[model samples]
Target: MRSGYSELLGSMRPTSTNAVVAGEADPSEVIEVSVILRRANPIDVSRRRSVLTREQLTERHGAQDNDVQAVSAFAASNSLSVVKVSQGTRTIRLSGTVGQFANAFDTTIVNLDEQGAVSRALSGPIFIPEALNGVVVAVLGLDTRRVARSHVQLVQSQNVLSSFYATQIRDLYHFPPDLRGDRQTIAILEFGGGYQSADFATYFHQEGLGAQPSVEWVSVDGNMNVPGSVDDTEVALDVEVAGSVAPLADIVVYFAPWSELGWIHAISMAVMESPVLPTVVSVSWGWPETLWGDMAISAIDAALADAVALGITVCISSGDWGSNDGTSGQTTEYPASSPHALACGGTVLQSDGVNILDEVGWPGSGGGISAMFPPPPWQNFGYSGRAVPDVAANAVHYKIHFDGADAVVNGTSAVAPLYAGLIALCAESMLGSHGAGFLNFTIYEDFSAQSTFRDITAGSNGGYSAQPGYDLVTGWGSPNGAALLDVLETLSFAQVQLQLS
Candidate 1:
């Protein structure tokens, strides 16, 4: 049965033939492909599963010292090293070459039942250094008896709250109503799933934005379809924010798989290829730099450089775990740490009924100097003289309405898209008048310009701290979006004056 299952799974391909080429295909172009894995039966024990508490198993095998010892002895005999023996959870994580012990444990591990027929095995490669997050747990020598296990707790949705104070911060820098007409296109990149149309429509209506903006998905490496089984909470937030700020602009969502190679390919395709060239691309996902090799990092750098050269601004999330990021000490998440992209940090925004009281850097917002890429020429004028968040926005627990659900998720994930929408407005104002060749270059030029940003003078992210003007914690601080638009408009006027002179 395991062999049959493996063969069936291997036959499933996410991509389809005759797919529309991203960054170049028309809006009407449609491609059919498998968007998600079929939901496995909840009781199917043969499929891999996470390790539950021993008390959970003790119901079938009476809770006694002999039973616990027998299980431990059995694991030891099979070369399974106990990674973390948690007495509180009564759960143990084991690591070993699963292929060797397949026959011995295959029938004993059950899914979620009293019957001893199922197995609670995980699927993925097993690695050493037991306590590490995202490690694969495996039985010795059983190729099929493995699971991708990570120690991180999935934050319950109920724990999240609206950081609507960020919205007030955004309101403080309101631009002229006329600026909204300038935005043409804003592109958001997603690796997991698409957004639900109903959720999008409801969000825009509540925001008082008439007629929902057109949203389309650009497929990369296959997997281009509307919202599916994959969690789309992040994607929904991105689309809602971008659409709310720049309703006139068309939103292009680039969907790809979550694999490292797949992401690299999708980004490159989006940069080199999408039908409507986006003025800005917002990315909210990333892993630690240590998890990625030089080659992957270099590939991302190259792709970002290409995007910037094409007059496209790339906004990336700094990460959510602050500096520790589930790792022990100081560490920075990747892609955000990449120098070419505009790294967006987070802020905890507080407000009264009518005005914003304070906006400070979010400590959990990832920011710091990169151990890999050096500071780019454009970042040299900033304060602190280090590599980090080039800018910041209202990302901490911002209120957003998603598909029939109203919830808030905090992280630089929210900030990146928020800024992307702002940039779309900036581009709409400038591109028609000033002919700003590269948006990134324009941002660099404006960093020292007094009216370009609101200087965040407080807060810190573990190793780094924020200061007036510029700092690693919040970069140039959160934007006064309206002020920024005016600045760009003024710059456009100046360019016109120079041309006339």
Candidate 2:
């Protein structure tokens, strides 16, 4: 429909420039762009009443001989099975359909006494079962019995250097060892509590890492504030490990109010609007994906896209429960399952004090192909299923001296932030040269090159097992920091050569 001269002018315009002339026909290249529809809201109700209080239930039943017995009785009476009960918070986890449990207890248990509050019997939507081959529905709840016996101990141990591997990898990548003095940033996304300054000061002192890095808190959606002692363990792990790996990098903690929506919103907001826009974002808490709706998923996707666009990397913990997750069948947990983000699974670093024996995928490490998201473009080289744990780090029973706590409470929660800090080191080396947008791409490409990683060929997380090359377990295997850096540097050099050529 346009004349030759008009078409010529349209073709000559710069792709990045936006310009329009009066009475001029728009170029055909500007045809209508297809819009990806936003996902729907997952929450059916905005809010629900709290369930029966621990005190009221105890009063009504006359304190049982032991909390576990009471919990077992409660589960049996409700036709529900108890999976795991946390002794610290008295949180009881029940199995069965969330809706079915909620309906059954809504009148008899949830609404038992007038003074007792009952929280919603929501499903543990994220805990997918791999054993069911992905068919059964499972729900999770807090077991109040375990929570009542609150006792924490702090102990000194040696697995503290595990976080340094990421930094080592980055050093090998580039940034000239002397140039490492440049300032960098690491952002940690947390859902509960604040870190204990005394605890961190003690950790750094014990590790001989010098003064602790500067830490700041950004509250997202009115949930930001200091968390009580009970909830500070996870926060402390995130702060300490992240700081340890990237000692020079400033650490920013973004706190979200407790609740699925609050957590998602906080993460999204940080990804899109944080002042530093951190080189890496580390997340530790996540519910199953089914708990969220399309809207939440879309928001997460958009946030990830924005992070990539801004050259920021996001790392998430797959989950603590193995593939079966004991909740539902074997379904990958959300945020981790999200194709847009890099899911950091867990691994055990076995050593005889002086000599490191081997590293294998942790049986409790969360991984597997996503049931909801298709394989990402960068993940194309691996087996066809939902490949997970694009990467891994030491997670099992690593030793660290907590300032106020005794006992080495081991979980994948520690591994996520440790890796995040390491990634910061790598980003520092690149100095925004790679545009974080392509890190995942770089990982896959490097994996194919076979020079940057130690393929984890053994171990299994429930139904899925690790194999040579890429598998549903450890994606590209554990990072060979020095080798990985070399690959990254090589890729960087290649990019420069391409520009010159």
Candidate 3:
């Protein structure tokens, strides 16, 4: 019989047709790859109050030792070096030359030119030994093609409807007055680009934020804070928005390469291995579901599940390309489409200093049904698949420091970090030190939680229209931050009681 992972391997494409083969990869150049192992027991973090420590989770759900040994033996036989292994993450890092990898996986490795970007790609199927067929799930880092795009767009001067500083937007959303996300940590994932300390200083200073929040940069796969690319705007927006809103919170940005392997590594390291574990993680980059292969999607979804099980909140920007998400037919972006994530959508807002004068769903906001994941029990909208966004916030007309200067940008990218900052404030209000994990159940099941939102009954994102209650375009609408804290506090109390019981 064929391998069970055949579909995933077949679906995984190294690059689009636009890329042309430049040359063969250097045979002697040593490279590293990440091999994902299957877990013995699956993890479910839905509506879970009890949290697990890194050690406990590893013991209960991580890969079996036998599996790890088998992979190591296979590496030894294939002349690949075992660089590292993480049982908690079910990953094994192997290093070998390009020629050894080609022979081991039964594929050709080549250099490809995709427009102006150059990448290393795989030209055929990755073979798996019959003995380890079911044990190994995914092999990443072989292909260096860019995996996803940041969803931020600069507003043309002529089309600027309204603009506000990141702090102004925070206050206009009615974020809790007493809480500045004290003692909370927000981890931001960046696939490319970087942030400069000077830009951050200038931004907070100009915004009148007396003291800047503390920030730390973590590199994954040797990717560092090198700015000046188009992606610099994305990095700037995330760091500034999240930091400005939660001024007392610690901000940790994990920089990684723009590949599937790099993406997975960034998230795993942030959630599992960070020095100061993050209470919430914000991801502003994503691709439509159709673009991600089954293996890549499954690997990421599993990692997100691990995050929630450990009581870490994962926030994802739904998308900025309307309901279609830049694909034909109605589609949603991955990671956001994953049920474990708090998918954030976008809105256009007109606020008069203290109150919201008008708020409507941004036409470019991404909201739709998922093609890969089933809706969790929390979602009761009768949709066959998981819904796109669980909540929304003002996305357009935001002031951010980008590429040495200030720029006005728009997209759901702003909303994820905005909500991530908000969640940090909520986490601060909780009775214990646990992070606010997996909020979809409460927001969908409890009317009290639903009441915290300012109902948006206007505008559309091409395929979906915003309505009084939950709609595809804006989900439960934008939040009233203080009210949300009140509801969350009550839930936290109940959770504590249940835990004690």
**Candidate 1 residue runs with Cα over 4 Å from true position:** 1-169, 181-183, 226-230, 381-386, 433-440, 443-451, 496-501
Lowest-lDDT window of 10 residues in candidate 3?
1-10
Evaluate model 2: give its lDDT. Answer: 0.53
The alpha-carbon lDDT assigned to residue 90 of candidate 2 equals 25
Quote model 3's TM-score.
Answer: 0.95
lDDT per residue (tens digit) for residues 1-501 in model 3: 134323225425736667899999888989999999998787777665468988888999998999999999989999999999999899999999999987777678998898978888877667777778778889888888887899899877567766789889889888987788788999999988888889999999989997688988999999999998989999999999999889899999999987889889999999888877788999999987877777877887789988888888799999999999987689999888998899999999987778888999999999999988887888888998998889999999889886678889999999999999999988988837474566776788889999999888999999999998998888999989889888988877887787689
Clashes of 1: 32
List residue ranges in candidate 3 displaced over 4 A: 1-11, 47-49, 157-161, 431-433, 499-501
| Candidate 2: tens digits of C-alpha lDDT, residues 1-38 | 21211110101101111222222121121111011111
Q: Weakest 10 consecutive residues, lDDT, candidate 2?
A: 142-151
Q: What is the TM-score of each candidate against the true structure?
A: 0.65, 0.65, 0.95
Ranking by TM-score: 3, 1, 2
Higher TM-score: candidate 1 or 3? 3
What alpha-carbon RMSD in Å does predicted model 2 have with respect to the real structure? 21.1
Candidate 2, superposed: residue stretches over 4 Å from native: 1-181, 353-355, 381-385, 401-403, 432-438, 448-450
Q: Say which candidate scores most in lDDT.
A: 3
- In each prediction, how many residue pairs overlap at the backbone (N, C-alpha, C within less than 3 A)? 32, 37, 0
> Model 1, range 288-374, lDDT digits (tens) per residue?
665554534553555565455455668888887776655666666778877667788887777665666788888877877677766
* CA RMSD, predictions in order: 18.7, 21.1, 2.2
